[model samples]
Target: MTTQLFVPKFRVDECLAQVKECLEKGWTGMGFKTVEIEDRWKEYTGLPHAHFLSSATAGLHLAFEVLKRKHGWQDGDEVISTSLTFVSTNHAIKYAGLTPVFADVDKYLCLDPEAILDKITTRTRAVVFVGLGGNTGQLDKVAQICKEKGIALVLDAAHMAGTRYRGKHIGYNADVTVFSFQAVKNMPTADSGMICFKEQSDDELARKLTWLGINKDTYARTAAQGAYKWKYDVEDLGFKYHGNSIMAGLALVSLKYLDNDNSYRRQISKWYRDELNGVEGIEIVPVAEGCESSTHLLQLRLERRDGLLVFLNEKGVYPGVHYTDNSEYEMYKDCGQCKNSVKASNEIISLPMHVGLSKNEVDKVSCLVKEFLKG
Candidate 1:
C-alpha cells in the first residue's frame, strides 16, 4: 500500500521533551507548567486573564456557567448558536441549562449574523458563536448585535487558535473565548484547553470553579514558603475541570511553533484556492474581509461528495468531513432554523490541511482531486 498524506503535522520528540520535564519534576499534577502556559497565553492574546482547563469542552462549560450565573439566567433560557459545529459546542450550552437556538450560516459556513436577529427573543440570554471551518466570519457583526442587545458573547473558538480579526485576536473581543489544544488542533497538547476571559471576577470565578470551588489553587499552597497550610472557602459551585502539569508542559512547547505551523497550513489553503478554484462543480469557501483564519480546516462544497471521497481514497488521498448536523442527533431536538448549515453539511468535504504536507504532496493531492472529476 502507498503512503497516505496525513493532514496535521506532529512530532513525538517535541512531546517527549515536555513529558520528560514532568517526570523529573514529579509535581506533574497541575502546577508549574500549567501556570507558565497561562502566563504565555496571557502574553500572546494580551487578554486580561487566562485559565488552562482539561479541554475546550470544559472551557465552554465553564464560560456558560459563569455567564449564566452572572446574567441570572433561568432554566431553558435560549442561547443563539450554530448547528454547524462539534456536538461538544452545543452540549456545553445544554450543560448550563440553556436552550440552544440553532442559527443558519453565511457563505463562510459560520453562524449568520442577520439570522441571529430573527432567533433572538426576550428569553435569549447569550450568543455562542462557533468559528466554523477555522474562519471568524462576520464575528464582528455578531459581537455588535450581542452587545447592543445586552446579551453575552461566548465564543466557541475551538478552531480559531491562531485566527485574528482586523489585527486583533478574536479571543480579546468576546466576553469569554474557549480554545482547544486537542490532538488535532492548531496547537495540540494531547488534550488540554484555555478559557481567556475579558476581565476580573469572571476570571477568578473560573479558576475556583474548575478546582473544586476552592478559593486558593494547589499552586498557591504548594509554592508558599511558611508552614504550607491548606485553608480555603467554598464559594460558587465548582468541578474537577482543572488541567494537569504534563499537558501544560506540552502546551508550552506547542505554543513556540504554533504560529509557524499555522503559517504553513495557510499556505496550503491558498494553494487549494489557486488550484481547485477552476475545477467544475467545486465551490471553495469565501474568506471574510479583515479577518485572518487559522486555516484549521479547508472545506469544499462539491456535487459528488460521497463518490469523490471514495475516489480520493482509492487514489491514496483520504479527505474528511468536519461534521454532521447537530439536529440530526437524537439527543438534540431540531430547532429547524439552519437550512444553510444542513445544506453545507450535506455537501462539505474537508481536504487534507496541516503543516505536515509538503509542497510536492500538496501538488499531488490537488492533481488527484482534479483527476477524480475527469474520470
Candidate 2:
C-alpha cells in the first residue's frame, strides 16, 4: 500500500456517538457541544480561557483584530511572522490590516527569536510565532522579548494541539494562542479550532466577535429565564467564525485520546529517527529541548528534497512538504527578506506522520528515503 503523508485516525464509534448526542438533541449549530468542548479544552490545556472557532484561521484573525482594537493599533502596524508556514498564519495578519514582517526560522523550523528582534520597529505591534511541527523553538525567549517590548505575542500553534513545554501545556505564556483541530491534525475534528487568550477580557471579546458581535450566543439565549434574554445588541462588526456543535462533538472525543495518540506519534518519530539519523545528505529537524512535541510532523532537510520527493512518489511512498516560503507567493513577494526561511523552504520534507502507521510502514518509508539518497 502507498504511504500517504497524513492519514487521520478516528474512533469511529466514539465519534458517531458524539454526533448522535448532537443529532438527538436537535441542536448542532454553535452551541451545546461547542460549549462543552470549549470547557474541556480549557480544562485540558489549563489555559486561562478557550473559545471554540470555525477554524484556526478565524481564531488568528480574531486575535489580531481584538488586540489591534484593544491597543488602538493603526492599520499599517507591523506583526513579525515566519515565512515558513501555511499562508493562513500570514493571511490572518492581513485580514486584520496588519503588515506581516517576515522573520527567519531556526533549525526547529520555528520562528527565530533573534530574527524576531531584528524585525521589530516602532510600528511593530505583535509577533505571530508558529510552533512548526509542534516544536517550541525559543518560544520562551520570544515571549520574554514581546513582554519587554510591550508587543503582543500571538502563537500560531496550529500544529501544537498537545505540545507541552517543561511539562506544562503551551499557550500559558503567550498573549494569545490558536490551535487547529482540522481533519488531519493530531486531534481530528472536521474543521475547528480553539483560541486561548491569557486574559479573561480578551476571551470575552473573542466570543462576541466569533458569533457576529452578538453579546449572547444562541445557547446562552436559550438557557436564560426572562424576555430580553434573546435581545442581544451587536457590539462590533464580527464574522461568522464560531464553531458548530457537530465539529465540537468530534473535538470532544479527539481531546480524550490526544495524549495517548501523541505518545504513539512520538514513538513513531523515534523509530524514524533511529532509521534516518546519521544517514548522509539528510538532516532530521530537531525538536526543541524540554518540549514534548505532539509529533505533528517529522520534517527533514536535504539538498535533493524535490528529487527525493519525486523518487518517493514513484516508489509509492508519499511524503509531503510542510510549506513553501510565503514570500515566494505573489501576495507576499515584497516581504521576502528571510534568507534562512527561503533556503529551508526548499529543503524541508514532512515524512508520513499519523496514528495509523505501523513500525514496518515507517521502516518502508525510511528505507525508501535512504535508498534514494544512496543514488
Candidate 3:
C-alpha cells in the first residue's frame, strides 16, 4: 500500500450532523453557519475581526485589494513576498495590480527578515509572510521589521490554522492574516478560509466587498426588515467570494477537533525528528523557537531531492514538494533574485503527514531515506 503524502480524515458523522441543520433550515448560503463559524474563529484566535470566505485565495486577494484601496497604493507598488510558497500567495499581489518582489527564505522555509529589509524600496508597501508548513519561523522578526518600516504585513497562513506564537494566535500582530481550511489542510473542509483583519472598519468593508460590493448581505437584510431584504446598495466593484453555509458547517465540525488533530501531527513530526535528525546528506527543516506549529507538513532538505523522491515512490512511500520557486514561473520570471528560496525550492521534500499517517510508516520512510542517503 502506498503511504501518501496527505490524506485528510474527516469526522463524517459530525460533518453530516451540521450539514443536516443547514438543509432543514434552507438557509445554506452565506449566513447562519458562516456567521457562527466566524464567531467561533474569533473566539479561537482572539482576533478582533474574522470574516469567512470561499477560499484562502479569495481572502488573500481581498487583503491586498482592501489595503491597496485604503492606502491609495498605486499600481506597480511592490509587496515583498516569499518565492517558496504556493502561487496563490503571489497571485493575490498581482490581482490587486501590485508587483510581487521575491524574497529569500530562511531555514524554516519562511521569508527571511534580513532579505526583506534588503528588498525594501520607496514603492514597497507591504510584506506577505508565509508561515510555511505551519511553522512561524522568524515571523516575529519580520513583523517587527514591517512595523519599524511602516509597511503592512499580510500573513499567508494557509498552513497555520492552529499555529501559535508566544501563547497567542499568529494573526494578532499582522495587518491581515488568511487561513485555509481547504480539502487537504490541517483543518479540512470541502474548501473555505478565514480572513482576520486588525481593524474593525476594514473587516466591515471586507464583508461588503466579498459579496459583490453590496452594503447589506442577504442574511443581514433579512434579519433587519423582511420585505426590504431584497434592497441593498453597491459601494465598490467586488468578487463573489463569500463562503456558503455548507462549507461553514463542515468547518465548524472540523474546528471541534483541530487541536487534537494538530497534536497528533506534532507527534508524527517528533517521530520523524528522532529518526532522521543529524543524518548526513540531509537536513530536517527547523520550526521557529516560539511556534507551537500545527505540523501541517514534515519537510526535509536533501542534496538529491529528485532522486530520493523517486526512491520513495518505488518503495510505495510517496512524498511531495511544497513548492517551486515562484520566480521561475513565466509570470514572475523577472522578479528579483531569491538565492535561498531557489536553493530550498530545489532541495525540499514534504514527507507523509496527516492524522492517518502512522508512526510505523514514519519509521519505514525514515529508514528508506537513511538507506538511500548512505548509498
- lDDT digits (tens) for residues 1-375 of candidate 1: 332433345566877888898899788887888889999998887788899999999999999999988778999999998888899999999999989989889999988889999899999999999888679899899999998999999999898887888888777769999999998888887899999889788998899999989888887887767764576788867999989999998888888888898788889998888899968988988879987888888888987888888888887787888778888888666656478988888899988887877777778878877887887
- RMSD of candidates 1 onward, in order: 1.6, 0.9, 0.9
List candidate 3 segments past 4 Å from native. Answer: none
**lDDT to native, each model:** 0.86, 0.93, 0.93
Candidate 2, 1-375: lDDT as tens digits:
788999998899999998898899999898878889989998999997999999999999999999998999999899999999999999999999999999898888888889988888999999999999899999999999999999999999999999999999999999999999998999989899999999889988998899888889998889988977778899899889999999998998899999999999999999999999999999999999999999999999999999999999998888989899998899999875688988998999999999999999999999999999999
Better of 1 and 2 by TM-score: 2
- What root-mean-square deviation over C-alphas does model 3 reach? 0.9
* TM-score per candidate: 0.96, 0.99, 0.99
In angstroms, how far off is 160's CA in candidate 1?
0.7
Whole-model alpha-carbon lDDT for candidate 1 = 0.86
Judge candidate 3 at residue 322 and give its lDDT: 92
